[model samples]
Target: MEYSKDDLIEAKRQIDSTLHKLKETVKTLESKENVSRLKSQITLAKRRIKAFEIANYFLENEIKKDK
Candidate 1:
């Protein structure tokens, strides 16, 4: 499925928000297990954000080429 620019942007925003929340949770957590879980989640979210950024970059380049 293809995502429009706006859709990608929204996805990126949501991912960023989630990442921020996860970081905050990490800071407040006392249990090693819980902190590890949150850290793993944060890592996954960061990877997703990178994926979105790469996708957006390619999409923008494609648009520029089409112009």
Candidate 2:
């Protein structure tokens, strides 16, 4: 799926929100397995956010070149 700049920004925002919630959940969780799962999810979210950021940078550069 093609994501517009706004969509990518929104996705990054949502992922950050989720990561914060997961961190809070980790603080309260006792199960090592569950904590590990959340940590993995956090890692995935961070990767996705990085991807979005890179895409956004390229997209913006292209737009500038066009102008």
TM-score for candidate 1, please give it: 0.48
Q: Put down candidate 1 lDDT per residue, 1-67, tens digits, no spaces.
A: 7666676567656655765665565455534555665676666655765665676566556555545
Model 2 worst lDDT window (10 residues): 22-31
lDDT of 2 by residue, 1-67 (tens): 5656666556656655665665555445534556665776656655665665566566556545545
Off by over 4 Å in 2: 1-36
Clashing pairs in 1: none
* Model 1 ranges with Cα > 4 A deviation: 1-35
Best by lDDT: 1
What would the TM-score be for candidate 2 when compared with the true structure?
A: 0.48
Local distance difference test, per candidate? 0.61, 0.59
**Candidate 2 Cα RMSD after full superposition onto the native fold (Å):** 6.0
How far is each candidate from the true structure, as Cα RMSD in Å? Answer: 5.2, 6.0
